[model samples]
Target chain A: MIDVRKALFGYSEWRWIFFFNKESWLSRKSKNGWVHKKRHSGKSGMALLLGPLFRSQNAPDPPPPPPTPPPELVWEDEV
Target chain B: MNRQLNEINLLRAIACIAVVVTHSITNYAKTYEPALFDQDKFITYFRFALLWATPVFVMISEVLISKNYPNGVRKGFLLKRVKYILVPYILIGLLKSYMHSEGQWSVFFQRSWEIVVLGHWHGFFVLVIFQFYILHILLGRFLQKSHPLPPILISFVLSFTYLYIHAGNKEYRVFIEQVYPFWDRTIFIGWLFYFVVAFYIGQNYERVLIFFTKHFYIPLITAVVSYVMMMNRVMDRVFVSVKSDRYDMLIFALSVFILALVLLRMIKKPNHTLIKLSHFSFFIYLTHQLTLPYLSNLTQTVANTFWSHVVILTFLGLATSIGWAMLFYESRLTKLFTGRIKALDQLAR
Candidate 1:
């Protein structure tokens, strides 16, 4: 039996979970309650954690849409 | 519609002149012995100083592309470039190959293949530019969204590393040679820094103009310092050759680029002469080498001194190239060879 809180959160801060995840321990809720699964995950777990950092931080806002056109008036020449 | 970048035209004109001068110096070196020319040090230093020319051309190309198509290029972009740039490149490559092959069909075909495919001659910049065109298409949205500083820094490192490895590592050189002989200049990695910096400048044109105006001395001092460092490296024998692809040349080129921007920004009104020269620059660049040999030979009899010969060669080279370019540009049939129809319309007015 493993303490899921201690395994996931660790003795340090929540941010330290990334460093502690090397054992590939993932906790899931089973019928019995919280069950720790020793899932052999790839680097994708770490990558998913850090992916947002590499994304564009300050993307420019999109341009505003053009104003709507006014209704056309009938002319005497057309009539 | 984008505002007219007259400063870019001025920069183009300056770059064109620098290129012509560099080629003139090279011609002098080729034709005459070192002992024959008393100004050997000056010529060498000047050549080193003008290493920024080709990179500046690359930067200008990027600046225009980024500025014009900020969102992304619409349909017919590749088609337009192929028609204007690739067509002329092939036509000129064939012409050059024909001239050099001496009427031998086999030799002509081989040379044509080398020139067009391998980028054998001075027109290798066309290959680099085409690579950037593709790169822009792929990375345009990402580059637009992200801040420019990181990309510029990253590209500089990549460019410098590639150049350094190519210059220092024998194995790497051999490997590159096995892959492509002209990889040093022809590869986009070697020139990526300039493109990234140009993208930033093009996107923030007014801001860059204002910044340069406020800090005009920054680029000027940097240019001087980098030039001195380059010359020192040459004197110390730290640098084997004075090619534009050196790691040190990247800094020097960037500084000179900024300096040129600051200096050229002072023109109150558009200089028609400079604009025309800039307009004719591409054609001039393509045809100048063809006329340079003849000009050098012709000037050799007239000018006895080193400076006189160089001056004569440069002047005649520019004159004849511009003359031919003007003729081709003005005429309807030959105007396609100039790679720009819009310039003809501008010139007409």
Candidate 2:
């Protein structure tokens, strides 16, 4: 009952789905504007550092925005 | 202690070592010398060979959990998981975070939260295992009275589609990365099939074992072919950080099946070494991430050649992980986190 062929190569029909980029999804949905949100800490920052190595081969996006300091830290420490 | 469970222990032992060796080769080689990782043929094949480690661990987890809760989810089982898995996870996460910051109180809480959520180093595997545990309970209830035919078929379609789409889909990957960026593999969908398949197999343990044993060549051939295909794909690509693709999962599941069949037949008696190592596997899993980088640094400083350096690092990393686990195993605190009175009871229980 194992469909080896399908298991190995069944996503051909939806291959076009792969091409529908998320950036386009973002742009089309946001009629007015969208903010470039900042990741202050946690795994997002780490991924921003290491994402290039494991990113999809088909992606055309630029590097992620630099992480902004947490608002609390910024407020307390800013000169 | 039962003969029936010996094979699972052996599998765990092998899988843990594979994980350590794979991490040592892939991470260290990439960090210290990228070209060597790229150019070296042995390292590539070695990584391919050992790539099944994490998936196999996942499968074993599903199998054991399914066995315990054959009918459906149990409150006791979930509570035990909280004790054995989540508690140690927090403890180990905090410990690693504190160490990473060298006891700096400022960053300790933030770092600990990161470590616990995203996992410190390879601790993401623990999170993946936890996710699978949760999925198993939820799915088991819906799947309680079904004939098991529908679920299997559904998992097949869902799992394969998931793999194919994720592997190919660029936008979805980016979206997922942006949204659930806490160690992407920890997502249950990526490993849905492995856990589901293992759950089914574990439920029908005897029949499946016999089937695999009788027609072993089918799986053997499947694994070999799949591995060859994956390796070919990896070689074709310039970037070599290939974790488990879908093909890799299929091959590894088959391989684990084949390995279980062979081990069950070949070894009637318990191998004390494997059992002992298996007892400490989770302990080692927690501590190995911390130990590997230090060992990698040491090996880089001490060893002369690439081959020698990698070999030293791999074995030393394995030994140090086991040693750390052994220290914890013998210590009085074994009962506190592990929930086991004696060391070997951790495996046997």
Candidate 3:
């Protein structure tokens, strides 16, 4: 095992990745990502909010950049 | 140790699982036409899945209310109401609206009432909790005083009545109609039944404990069968028109029984981690939706295939949920937010 207590002295990229951009890199980038994955993850109220109704694939792709909902023509009703 | 388990609490967790399935199935239906289960199944059978999910919440409310103010219902303490129920409800709704800001600021605000009051129509869960609070003292007295049969029979009749009406009434509200329709307490057609059921079931401490410990598989089988029957709309004509209230209580009974059993058994050796996880279950439900969109945005860049995306999302979902639970359990935030009320504080279990 790379004695992490000793590895703390490492410099440059190690320090940068270690300190600055930590969680995203570690969770998404570094190989140990899976082991040290974020505990609170990709859940939200909207999922529950819109849930038990719209069943997506276990985890769907990032929803194709979320195509904007068509603009409602509120004024058209008055006409 | 075998007996002390809160079966109702266990069923609450079962409700959590059902919510997971319901959401999963709902997403599938919205995106793809044919779902794992038909739309109708959700109301008739699966909707019952939600029955326990939130009414267990009602029981929780009654228990908490009775514990806190045993005398009479507080007239209208805005601050008190806001502290627990209102604050969480509004804050969560606002967070949902902000995250899901589907349109312009005006549009979101226009619908904020919808979200705040209705919560994707699932808001009925909160309303039901409020209903329980309003009825707590009375309901508690009723449960204490009356034999279980009257409430049970009343709830049964009311549920059947709702099922009959919902079926006969052809007009669709879109909002009230789930893919499959039925008389559901969550949507409040026959909610009185479920509310009373929760109250009654909650009152019998020994029966609750025994029920959970005794017949575990019956519920498991019932849930599985209910899922199948409702998913297929097999009982529609006989039970309800669009969907059926056919065997909802049976399903709930099974779900609750099984859940109580599981919770009792599992809780025997609940370590710190499990306790912590259980502790955060509510927050998990409350906040998970907030976290998902952010993760979706972040991961869209890195994740390649649909499969990989889902894996990441699932992993992240579990991780973030646990993380949040851990944070709350370990942090000062729980205390800070909860205030000085200590005894009725939600247990990790």
Candidate 4:
């Protein structure tokens, strides 16, 4: 016998998860900041894997400033 | 700021009435065998002619969205829809599940979840509309900047091809079912052409109005001819079902949409009654199914003939739906489900 519950609800949820994951991944990859940096950083694997499931909470924070920045640039950025 | 489009209000009234009529016929038809009624063929023709109803509703939504947000929507767009539209959708789904649950908790929860997620109900149009909302956010700007003709043609082909494959090919249909069950109607591919076409029309409202006004006969003629062809296909069993998503209906629906705009333009004075009906349309759409069965039972007592039953049911459905919606609209707390949000009203003007 067919599992009616899975046929009705499970299939659509799985498709939705797949769609959102693809969309968020592509969008994040195309953007130019922490999202891109986070994807390339060594800790990105688990974050990428769990991104779709906990998109809001697991959103990558802003990347820190480069340590070797010029003093003027650092002052302007601080200002 | 957008000017008040009185024509959109009238069009909303017309589409809302057509939807109620179509559902009324469906309910009455379900009560008896098709062969039992002598007017079954005519009823079929009428129902098929009104296939434009739901598609027009979808087009109206895209038109407003594209026109209102030509530069693209801000961040709060989807959030507003979730509050006004999705909340009511889920509330109604739970209400429906409760009605049919027969006091069983498991059945209630399961059915409620199915209705919420799978859209296994008459109000599945909400899910389809939600898809268009996301589509607008994603593609509306690109579509606005590009030439309309190419995208229109491409979307038409995509819509027609998808419908043909889903309806004509059983093997693919079954395969699709495995991957995305209960998505034959809720998916965007079957209705993409309407969105693309309506997006352009909404962006170029004045030019489109002038063109349609100058050549009113064009859509009128095409609407009649395509409708007749649709009826012929149905009679010949070329369409195995009486669904609105048939490939043949794409042309018919588009023509009726243009024709409606032309006809509504001829009137000078604003129709207050139609405007009110338009205001209550979304709420009516949500709650009409709940009231229709009870109204059908009441109408059956007085009307012996099939046509009389259907006509009476249609009127009662519209009236009671509007009446109940008005009662709900009177309160601040209950107004969320009525689709008459103050923000939306302000935006409309």
Best by TM-score: 1
Query: Residue by residue across B187-249, what tens digits does model 3's lDDT show?
Result: 543556655655654455457546655766666777677656644443433333221123354
lDDT of 2 at B264: 59
Q: Give per-residue CA lDDT, model 1, range B64-133, as digits (tens).
A: 8988888898899999999888877887778778878989999999898888778877777888888888
Model 4 lDDT on a 0 to 1 scale: 0.76
The docking quality of candidate 1, as DockQ, is: 0.01
> Between which residue pairs do clashes occur in model 1?
none
After superposition, candidate 3 runs with Cα above 4 Å error:
A1-79, B1-14, B28-81, B100-105, B121-123, B172-189, B211-228, B234-250, B257-259, B291-312, B321-349
Tell me, per candidate, how large a share of the native contacts it keeps: 0.00, 0.00, 0.00, 0.00
Best by DockQ: 2
Q: Choose 2 or 3, whichever is better by TM-score.
A: 2
lDDT of 4 at B318: 91
Instruction: Give the runs in model 4 whose Cα sits over 4 Å from its true position.
Output: A1-79, B1-4, B34-39, B341-349
| Clash pairs detected, candidate 2 | none
TM-score-superior candidate, 3 or 4: 4
For candidate 2, write residues B99-198 as lDDT tens digits.
7776678788778777787753456777888888778767876765677777767766776676666666889778878998685657777777777778
Candidate numbers sorted by TM-score from highest down: 1, 4, 2, 3
